[model samples]
Each structure stands twice: as structure tokens, then as C-alpha cells.
Target: MTLLKGWRYGAFVGFIAGFIGATLYPIVISPMINSDYYKQIQKETRAGVNQEEIQPGNMKVWSDPFDRKK
Candidate 1:
């Protein structure tokens, strides 16, 4: 019924808690933390502006670190 009320049960509970946390993170936590098109309008606005409109070296930038460098 009870968990022995010491480090052993605490560790077991902690393990279960961490397991549940890791398991639920992708399902329950990731979606809320992710963003989809939240700043699309601003991005498109920047992208539409030409070099004359925006300064150099600040063009519409999209970088994915997972991809290789140019």
C-alpha cells in the first residue's frame, strides 16, 4: 500500500517520476513549447524587403544548424 517511506521508495518514485516525465515530455510538453507560424507575418515582411529596403547582412535569414554550412 505504502512505499516504505525512505530513500528506497523515494528513489523508486523518483525513477518513475523521471520516466513519466521523459515519456510525457514529447507528448505533453513539446507541442506547447513549439511554435508554428507564430512570426510568419514578420518573417515574410522582412523577406519581401529588398536590400535597398533593409541593410546589408540582415537579409531574410533562415538557418538550420542541423544542415551543413554553406
Candidate 2:
């Protein structure tokens, strides 16, 4: 019983730590790591080349099927 409880406690702690790390990495770590890439994108955008036609694997930059702006 004691061994089982210890295993459960270790598993719970490990799971919580992993979850926190995963959550914080994208918000805190990724931007810092990719700062150079982001700067390049900003430069391209400022140069008016950011609106290139989307390719098959690229994300949809914007869409409005309902013509809501008009």
C-alpha cells in the first residue's frame, strides 16, 4: 500500500510538471527561440511581400465568406 501510494504521488507530480512545462513553453519560450524568424516575417510584411498567394500547406491568413465588412 505504501509503495502504491508513493508511485501514485510520483506519477501525479510528474504529470503536473509536464503539463506546466508544455503550457509555458509556447507562450514564453517559443517566441524567444524564434525571435529571428519573427523579425524576418515582420520585415517582409513591412516590405509589402507578406500577402503572397497561399500554398497548399500554408494556414489560411484571412477569410470572410459572408462579406461582413460591406
Candidate 3:
């Protein structure tokens, strides 16, 4: 009974290790193997952030273009 339990534990550990390795292998290699994938993603995010940053002060509120109550 004890020997069977030990083998079961070993099998469980092996399954977990294999699952993690399979998942991580692609993520670890993708950025290194295809650099442009991450670069393009980051570039788009930065451009969106910059657009939002610029719009607040430099852009207009056309509804109040003529006058203001406050």
C-alpha cells in the first residue's frame, strides 16, 4: 500500500512538471524568437497612451467655445 502511494505521488509530480514546462516553453521562446511581436504590442499601447495624454489639454471643448458660466 505504501509503495503504491509513493508511485502515485511520483506520477502526480511528473504530470505537474510536464504541464508547467509545456506552458512556459512557448512563452519563454516567443519573445526571444519573434522579437517584433512584443515590440509591436508595446508600441501600440504607448501610442494610445500618448494620444490620451495629448487630448486633454491641447484639444477643445467646442460646446463652451463661445462663453463659460464658471
TM-score of every model versus the real structure: 0.43, 0.53, 0.38
Report the C-alpha lDDT of model 3 over 1-70, residue by residue, as the tens digit.
Answer: 3554677889988999999989987889667989998899989888746554567767753465668777
Show model 3 residue runs off by greater than 4 Å. 1-4, 33-70
- Output the worst ten-in-a-row residue range by lDDT, candidate 1: 33-42
> Best-fitting candidate, measured by TM-score?
2
lDDT of 1 at 8: 87
Report clash pairs, candidate 3.
none
Better of 1 and 3 by TM-score: 1
| Sort by TM-score, top down from the best | 2, 1, 3
Instruction: Give one digit per residue, the lDDT tens place, for model 1 in 9-69.
Output: 7998899999999999988787667645446656877775666555568666555769987
State the lDDT at 13 in candidate 3: 87
Q: What value does the lDDT take at residue 60 in candidate 1?
A: 62
lDDT of model 3 at residue 58?
77
Each prediction's RMSD to truth = 7.5, 7.1, 11.2
Residues 1-70 of candidate 2 have per-residue lDDT tens digits of 3554677989988999999999999999999998998999888777844544643467666677887775
